[model samples]
Target chain A: MYSPACKVTDIASLIPQRSPIMMVDDYIIEDELNCRSELAVGADNMFLDETGRLSVEGVLEHIAQTAAAHIGYLHRQAGETVTLGYIGDIKRCAVTGPLPAVGTTLHTHVTVISQVGDVSLVSAETSAENNPILNCRMKVAEG
Target chain B: MEKDELVKKMIEILADEFEVEPEVIQPEANIKETMHLDSLSLVDMVGLVNEEFGVEIKTPDLPTIKTFADLYDYVFTRM
Candidate 1:
């Protein structure tokens, strides 16, 4: 069984990313096909632009990392190494609101739309509170 | 799936995703070279296989695949 709440320190082992660059704080696998993750946006986040707002690319990465975390959690459960995964492509990405500010909690939800041979196409959306922030379809590849 | 049927299905997927005629893809045709597959299209191919066949292809293994026949054999063995 997997815990719903994960410690921030354990995020690193689930994903290949490290601090400052790692956007997700913790995550939960809701089921076999869906996962949810959250990040406490801070001034130290590397994706902040000159305006101190998270860039569009940052939002995409946030969603991608959440998906990665889900995959990682499964790998760990199977007693396998968490393999490296890459964002093969991003499509239909729409930023609907102002970039979230520091101190805001970003909640990301990812659903596996399809998966074939180490490649998965996922639909992801991010929100702050009930307000929608971004949505997109992403292709993830395992390496 | 039979070998011939599998090859046909893979070819159809490749043709549809790449926007090429199915007749263009031969068993020995180099997919990347003949289809002019860009990096993004290559990723789409991976996603297609995963969704259609329940396979999980890794990027490192891509280098080993040069022809449609090679891809077919790979997926066939795994299945």
Candidate 2:
């Protein structure tokens, strides 16, 4: 039950996502190498599958945005604006449990594994209602 | 670690991660060419080495390490 340092209203200022596609609603930076975020699932969410559960793509996007928010926060701390970042690669991605339905909140934890140049490797774990849902490593490059 | 032991360990690690045969990792072979690595995949290699050997491969030093022998030397000296 980590408290969010940045609320839904401030999410837009940290990451580039906007509107219906925006996944992260709350964010918290734990330290230089770790962060956490949450996304509240809604019926109108664009990423829901026909089975009425959040799709795998949605989960991956959420993880990616969490990493984006981490990078965004660091840049802001350095007195720089958030830069566009691309998903250079994803590795060891696995769906570990059931997907969330509307009304559930997705909690994600991200750890910075390494960074060389403008590219960073991050490990992400997402859970829905305290049940582990997804885990993966992502490579994000500043664009 | 001894150079022979380090070289043996690196080959097993890199070959498995890059999905190549262990025998293909010759000392004088061009690492990028043998591994078919682009800029993005090159980062994967760096991460693997760091994780397995605890050696941080600096991005700027990448150009200096052209062959498998150079990579072996880099990790051996650092370890």
Q: Which ten residues in a row have the lowest lDDT in candidate 2 chain B?
A: B38-47
- For lDDT, the strongest prediction is 2
| Deviation of model 2 at B12, angstroms | 0.3
Write model 2 residue lDDT over B1-79, tens digit each, in one string: 8899998998998989999999999999999999999878888888888889998898888899999999998988897
* lDDT (Cα, tens digit) per residue for candidate 2, span A42-95: 999999999999999999999999899889888887889998878999999999
The candidates' interface RMSDs, in order, read 4.8, 1.3
Candidate 2: misplaced stretches above 4 Å? Answer: A1-9
lDDT at residue A102 of model 1 (Cα atoms): 81
DockQ scores of the candidates: 0.20, 0.48
- TM-score for all models, in order of appearance: 0.67, 0.90
Model 1, A28-112: lDDT tens digits are: 7777788888888899888889988888888888998998888888888889999899998888788888788888889888988
User: What lDDT does the true structure give each of the candidates?
Assistant: 0.83, 0.89
Q: Clashing residue pairs in candidate 1, if any? A: A115-B50, A116-B50, A116-B55, A117-B55, A117-B56, A117-B57, A118-B56, A118-B57
